[model samples]
Target: MNPPSLSFRARARLSRSAGALLLATAGLASLAGCANYAGIRSDKQPLDVARIDTAQSLPTQGGQWPTMNWAADFGDTQLSSLIAEALANNPSIAEARARLDRAAAYAAGADARRYPRVDGHYSVKRELYSGNALYPEPYGGSWYTENNASLSASYELDLWGKNSAGLAQAISEQRASAAEEQESRLALATSVAQQYNALAREYALFDVAQAEARERQALGQISAARFSAGLDTQVETRVSDTQIATSNTLVSQLQGSITVMRYQLGALLGKGPDRGLAIARPQMQPLPVSALPDNVPANLLSRRPDIVAARWRIDAATQGVTIGKADFYPDINLSAAAGFDAFGFGHFLQFGSRQIQVGPAIDLPIFDAGALRARLKDRYATFDTAVATYNDTLVRALTEVATQIAQIRSIEQQQHDAQAAYDAAAKAYQLAVIRYQGGLSTQLQVLDADRALLQQRQTLVTLASQRRDQQIGLIKALGGGFDSAPPPRRDALDAMTSPT
Candidate 1:
């Protein structure tokens, strides 16, 4: 037997052979399960958001652009109050705010993974074991209880940037959500202001309708006097009656409109119809007239909340693509565990019962029939959608601003023409009334002048309302009411502590 023993070098060679055999098996398994990339394509084109150019000057628009809190520029406390209420209680805004909270939580969860993770584990068990003397049908059995407790820790190597890419994507989404919340606030505030403007407009029209009714009554009284004295024709009397009826109808219709608008304002304030009924006519304020700079700043696009949110979404999608590609590489994780275990309770804490384990694990994604490639394709598609969305948002935002500038210009010219017409007609009506009272002009002539005056005054009212509407429209289109959000921690923390 001693003569047949092999040398140490021969044993070393045999061990090397066994290792080679294991490696060969691994290679064969990889080949057998490998994925094909024949139809899969990698789209690596550089991404960009479209830049829509716009001319910056309009004849009728003047005064520098309205500053933030533009509703205050109108100097209507009621309007400011409505906007504040909407921002606080609008359901849509609350939903968006909730979304921001969810995104912030996701961001924190993702970031937490950058460091190591530790966990505690414990277990208790009772087992029966056979002690074999002859190992017959019913061998002697003994019962024993075991207790174990352990602490385990693990961390990822992040060798190929997979974890970092995931973290980046999550953070980008959080920022995007914050921007979306800003957009929501801006939209709600603008909506409240527009509704308030509508209420003001209705009140102005109601006043004009009442004035027309008064003029109609005066004319009707003169007609009745002439008819009773047999100095007026029946046709003239009928015409006066018809005109009076028409004026009353207009006045009633205007009152109805005013009622409806007040209700609408109440709803925008997150209140009920009764709240609107308590409101009075808006104190007239100077029309909002603002001019933008000729050269739109490069950062102007970035300032728009929607555009900013869209860009962040694109960034998040890009990181998603990175994460998908990273899946093709091997992932390495290091783990460790230390604990105590014993068959009996008394010795559970003894040195001989101690246990510890430490090691590294490697996962190779060498198989799966095109699953990884398919996932990568899906990610690329998401990225494409994000880019398209961003482009569309940018173009729309720029268009809104440009169209508003032109609209304000045209409305200003109309206001000028209407004021001139009102002045001329008013003078004519005053002179005609004086002449008739002095018995120097016919009743029919005085009535004609008064009707003309009413028409011109109504035209002025309509123009003023139109200017107010356009002014608010332009301000909203320019995103003039909101600023950047407060720091994320303050907002996110508040959301976390908010009641369910």
Candidate 2:
């Protein structure tokens, strides 16, 4: 009455079919239990550079971008050398480089995750077998030496692109770090230049102060002669002596400022203050005509190191969002372990003592109590923040360039008037001195004209310094000669709305 038994081949085929059905059911269950990530996404949109208007602020004529050796253009070899030294030795640059190296290390680790991992382990121990345990006969209640050796391997199935996304995110971060390093270099260079320019201005002003003191001394001699001749009172001679003292005080103040400026330069060079003393006075060339490049905001994204760094951070955040979404799916890994084990060392290497294991491990986020959702939401928020930061940086960059341009134009107009005033004051001082020598004017009149001339000279010096400073500002605003390829036109919206 019993049914006929199936052949070996038929039994094997049925076993295969049953195994397939089981796997299919498990897969469906895993998919059904996946954490929900619906309705969570970044909302911010990056600003489109093409849409922003900059017609009035930027000049229409085409101009060249700043060269890599732009500091050399200032005609100060010392400035160029100082910038080179700062770039090499500055702590800020070193910190940025360290960040870049760390990011690269992280990227390498992520890349390693995409491939299979293998590990080997070996152990030796002395153990006691219990009589009530699985050990048989004399083996029970005996102490023996046990040996174990194993080689295990595992590979994650990135069906959800988790590992790949992580690698991409790390790469973006590395790129951002690199751009940040460049930014630090640019900042240091410009700072050194501005400080050097200030030192030069102080030196020029010091020369004028010394000249004024000499003129005051001469006037004092003349006033003394007039008093002796009974043509002027002691009051004029005392006034001339006070004027000379004031001029000398100004010279002393300038000397102190020059010393402090040198100290600052030495610090920028990553050396002692004495290094700055070795720095000769900067012989800055005439300011080049200020103009804008043919490309404005559109190309500025790539030209400016800060903006480029911001764009890379956006890419990194996008990848982070992708990684968060992937966390909602099942993490499947295939693992295999083969090893030899024996109660005693004598038989540990025997074929009969060998064992092997192979299986797929699944980690499904079935009941994480909304942890996965929270993480994904955080990622989306980070993405939104990055997009907003990038937009803000772009807007600020444009405004900076425009503000520098406007200031430069204003300075140009002032320089012309300043030159004329200086000429007129020089002529008036000459006439006053001539009249005083001819006894047609009082010594006070000559002193007044000299004061006016000194004022005009100082004004001209300040205007010239300001014009140079504005030129440097404009150069920095235009990206300080840094250049790179444009980032892809993707933004937060593209990342948030993409299919999970």
Candidate 3:
């Protein structure tokens, strides 16, 4: 024990260890700094400069806009009027507009989250007191009332850009919804135009049927006269009567279809079925004489509203991941409260009653049994889904463009061939009628030729209408004319048009 006592100073020197601990702590802090910096940069990198360019090759470029005025594009005033009515009254449009309003309002609210929150409140309370203890002599209880008023304030400091991310996500969603509304508009316009074209074709067919019926009725009268004169058989008169009956039935069916079309048009304009909405038949405008562009798919991303909406979805998901990850870290917030409190109303504003406090509050997540981790996992999965959906939408959009292009071209050729057939059939029918009158061909053969002519004409009309419909489809698949709109303003329309 005497020998160990001599080593006290040496033992104290050997036990000193704070220098090593300081060095280790510094190294760990450096590593954390590097990790945090890397993460912030990573979050920012993915969102830089994400935009699509337009190409002259996209069919949407053929028109200045997605033909939001599709009916007017066809040069029909009646159709334009109907479209206007539909836009004003359609339930879907109204719903979309309301949703847009709500989104704008929410975006405004979200933006306000970045600012301090202030609230004023007043309260009144009554207290009952009993004095029966050793320090007091009173044995009765008395009630008292007090009133206090205060203004409190709270604000979360966006230390890690969490509030910014949330706001961005909300704004992006608003933009996507607006794009969806545009998509719906384009779809509705296409439907109206297509249905109008169909109605017109039906009318053309009706005209042909009525003409044929009139001719057949005249022929039936002649057959009846001939049969009475012993020149034609009852079987021939019956055949004429049967043809007339068939043509009359067809006319009736076509008339019913027209009525149905009128009802449909009225419904599109948000009117009751019996509103007697009149849809004047839209005659076919001449086929587009402009040259068609060939072989480009890149512009579909920029021109289509659905494509824009999908991209916005991806942006929103990306922002969501950021916000979720931020939750894993500490939340820095600033809160303040100021108020007046006193036992009497006269003393409420006194110096002793005045109170004010302000401070920063930090919330650190120490443990939640993996709750934050699971939420982060879910958000990442959601981001992945968004990415996949965006890619799929792009692929589908390209495919639609290609398919529509092919359809348009094929319909064009079909229209040409049908026109030739109609011309030849018309000439042949005329010649057959002349030949039959001159006793070179039978009346039955002339009737057959006339029917053939009508069929050929109807086929031509249908092919032409199909081409029109396909053109509209191609425009839609290519993303319409959103690009043609001026760049969005930063304030008023920002919530609607911005990628949040």
TM-score of every prediction relative to native = 0.82, 0.93, 0.80
User: How would you encode candidate 1's per-residue C-alpha lDDT over 84-181 as one tens digit per residue?
Assistant: 78788788888998999999999898888888999888899986666665344333476778999888899987866778988998988998898898
lDDT of each: 0.71, 0.85, 0.67
RMSD of each: 9.2, 5.0, 11.3
**TM-score, cand. 1:** 0.82
| Backbone clash numbers for all candidates listed | 0, 0, 3
- Best candidate (score: TM-score): 2
Ranking, TM-score, top scorer first = 2, 1, 3
| Model 1: ten consecutive residues of lowest lDDT | 488-497
Candidate 2 lDDT over 43-69, as tens digits, reads 688888888988777656687788779
Please provide, for model 3 over 144-221, each residue's C-alpha lDDT reduced to its tens digit, 9 standing for 90 to 100. Answer: 567787888898868678889889988988887898888787777677767777777788788878987887787788
Q: How much is 17 displaced in model 2, in angstroms? A: 10
Pairs in steric clash, model 1: none
The deviation in Å at residue 45 for candidate 2 is 1.0
